[model samples]
Target: MKRVLNLVLQSAKPRTVGSLIFSRNKQKMAVSPSLNSLSKVPKSSSPKPQIFNLLTTTPKTHFKFTPIFKQSTLSLFTAGHANQKPTIKHHSNSSTRCLFTGIVEEMGEVKQLGVADHGGFDLKIHANTVLDGVKLGDSIAVNGACMTVTDFDKRLNEFTIGLSPETLRTTALVELEPGWKVNLERALRSVDRVGGHFMQGHVDGTGEIVGMEMEGDGLWVKIKTEKSLLQFIVPKGSIAIDGTSLTVLNVFDDESCFNIMLVGYTQKHVVLPLKKVGQKVNLEVDVLGKYVERLLGAYKTS
Candidate 1:
């Protein structure tokens, strides 16, 4: 009975010790917080862990996030960089028929006259027209040919414009001198009313002023043209002789020169009657020459 009592006491002591170890382990686990429980804890109670997570995770979310407004803004910036502005062209506003004004500075004196080697003469004009109202740089149309005022004479209405050798052979002005009368008109201005045909003040060549005869109070003047202008010359066709508009009286096939029969009114109002035989007159072929040239040029290109 004594041996049985000692063995039972030893076994009961081991059982009590095991039960105490198990109860202590369970109490520690209950006191400790899990991941979900930590999230529910007050921020003030766990500031250190909360701050660490915010610093690390905030940067990752910012890097990964993309807003719709930011994508649209980026697309607009890229389009602007790739696009280019369009270019515009400007044109000039001036007509081809623009005529410049020319003030006569002097009444040139004729030095010598006759046919020239190139079919015109060297006309020597000594006049004061250059010194009175004209400058050395002024432009003048001598018999409708644009020429620079080269010399001046202040005492006398005199200026000099070189007549080409071809002009002497064709026009009666080749025989003009100090006492001869010259018909003069200023250049047409933009504001000035256009009274006659467009005059370029460019004389193609000269023509002979054949005759000035009075018939029944009217004057009839005749001019001889070169073979080149014959086709363009027609009766009643518009012609500018010495910058004055004149009509063709009769265009004869037999003769190279055509006649301009002027009425008595034109003979009195204008300088038609002043014209005499053997006198040279400046001639402009026609304005239609430009239109014909343009049409032919376009046809060739096509």
Candidate 2:
């Protein structure tokens, strides 16, 4: 019994002992190679090699090491792909469109054709929508609302977006008479740089422009919203008002309202400066907060 106990202790001390034995299909067990054999292994030179091969023990079997490489400052980023530009893939269908980043540039022209008898408005389009891969029949966001391009002229940089009766009823766009300004953006592409939080041109609801005053080099806009909408808003969180993505500066008065400071650059660029108090604009709360709420709800119930 004492001799058996000695063997068990020796087997447990792998570093000091020579062999560890167990029965799988008890046969001749190949003892593990000693640390001396690894020390004798030649250094590897393959760039970003995941496994270290000391020596080819056989034609098929190699002594692979998945352990950390003992090297000084190994770079994970390689110099080879630094200059390679990513090629943007184009899709002919609008449904599979990439919801990348929203566009702020002044591009695309929208002209009204005669109002349809069915109660929608037809529009003629032509303008330089700087976004690449904008094929005809693709979707574009006009003034923060998604619109489908009915026709286009590539050379002239023109396309058309039609507004249905439902769109006019739900949006402040109904106020758009002849000769009004709007911001236009093509549907997001996969390669477009994400400069802001994700926004879908769906227009979750609308908020009124309550106040606009000069604070710094920009204008401070205070918007009044439903208490329900404000629940999803947080100070420094992203919210899209009037289709323009802006960060909330603060939530005021029990979260019934919020303020966003627009820099001079944004104020000058967007049609937001043209908006007036008591006028309503589209509002889309950040999608991230809702997803987080759902995930937290799952844990709470569990």
Candidate 3:
């Protein structure tokens, strides 16, 4: 029996012995050169050790390496590339756009025949449209200010309207020269779809039309309004200057005036800066102001 055992052990190769021992009880078997040779073993200097350490021992939070066996692919079914730019669609008329007719083109002449203590003045405006298809008490925008057509001359194409000294102080029409341009839009009616707004034809206050000049291919007009109206005016905020929707720009707290910046496009197409210095532009605080005020009032009470 002893002789037979010795022969059997001697016949077995070192690699074969290691394999047999490992297959029987791998946990108890130590890795050795005999076992290494049997399995076409990897080279000792292989990059696998470093790669294993990077994936296992190093904190997952510190290193972001992904394993080849665990890798996944992402498929996109969308038509365009992820980084492609999107196309933009242009509309015909933006809300900021204002349209006016030809009748009251130039600034009308203001003749203050009389004045009252309550800031009132008897004024005369010689305008073609004011006299055309217009009757007494009809609303007309004079220099961007809304005024009732108190009287008109069909033959001469001229008209007359009354303005309080308050109106004079609040609008650019106060300093109107006979040939200056004035913007005109009729008052909205219930049958009308309220194209602009419910204009009272009453000027709340007047703002100073200042800093008028050519900017690029268009004219740039700036106006200064009282600080009381500043809170209601936001950048690109809507404000009615002489019944025209003008945008608000550059609002300041300490200053009494809020600056209204107008682009050249508005100047060329709209009657924004046609008046001179010390000219009063009838200003109507945005209708949104009343709603905002109501909301704030409700909150305070609540």
Candidate 4:
């Protein structure tokens, strides 16, 4: 019995060495020879051990490594990594993106609103200061909504913008009528000072004016919005209403409503004061709050 066990142990030694090599690089390995032939591996002058590179494999599985020095970026691509061609998506009417500071530059009047030839609505607004140095494809925030300038007339001080179905569904701009006033702001420039909190000119949703009253020289305004949006609106937080940056005074979570104050100076500058109860206004919650919530959600899931 002792002699039979020794023969079995000697036969299993070679297979163990072959498996060690396969586990190190995860490559197809062949059966190795016994300990008597172990010195057959070639010696190298370099002190470092040899490392395997996958690029030397078959053409279809080969990958390329490119190092960019400008920004210290490394990119890797392989033939088998992607089976389909990459595609880029573009909006039908707009081609550029812009950001705002939630500061109303002027009050633009709605001159015309009609359907566009290529689906969606075409809006024409009459404005003064926002048109300065404006180009045909420049972005303009109308009522806290970003819109591309499809056409502009310097002499008439009017510009045309195309609105998609998504924009109409999310914003109060759908309720606009001729002669109605809307807050307008040109995209912020690198040199311009940030007078208000950062805004993307993307309206989260529309809120209806539920209550209003005068508090000495300042006016108190209450707006009722969707309950889901209340999580982002907190007392003493920043909010954008119709492109006007205002600080929230109170948040009635139970009622799904919030209140903000408009000083005498602000009342004269923005069109929010002109809006009466039951009127719909574009609302943008603080972007930071949304980002925090998204990050927390990722942690919870993980």
Best by TM-score: 4
Off by over 4 Å in 2: 1-92, 95-97, 107-110, 117-119, 123-126, 130-133, 153-158, 253-255, 295-302
Report clash pairs, candidate 2.
125-159, 126-158, 126-159, 127-157, 127-158
Q: What is the C-alpha RMSD of each candidate to the true structure, in Å?
A: 15.6, 19.0, 18.4, 16.2
- lDDT tens string, model 1, 204-294? 6677777777778767777777777766677877677776667677887677888877676555544446766876677776668656767
Clashing pairs in 4: none
Which runs in model 1 stand beyond 4 Å of their true positions?
1-133, 153-155, 164-172, 268-272, 293-302
Superposed by TM-score, candidate 3 places the C-alpha of residue 43 at a distance from the truth, in angstroms, of 99
TM-score of model number 1? 0.51
Candidate 4, 41-128: lDDT as tens digits = 6432444875665455333436755433334323255444467677688764332356788888889899999897777689999999
- Overall lDDT per candidate, in order of appearance: 0.57, 0.68, 0.57, 0.84
Which model is ahead, 1 or 2, in terms of lDDT?
2
Worst 10 residues of 2 by lDDT: 16-25
The lDDT leader among the candidates is 4
Candidate 3 residue-wise lDDT, 153-258, digit = tens: 7776667677756676655565655455556555443454553444444556777766676656645556677766666667766667765665666666665566
Ranking by TM-score: 4, 2, 3, 1
Cα misplacement distance, residue 225 of candidate 4 (Å): 1.0
For candidate 2, the per-residue lDDT at 37 reads: 49
Q: After aligning candidate 2 to the native by TM-score, how far in Å is the CA of 72 from where it should be? A: 58
Cα deviation of 108, candidate 4, in Å: 0.9
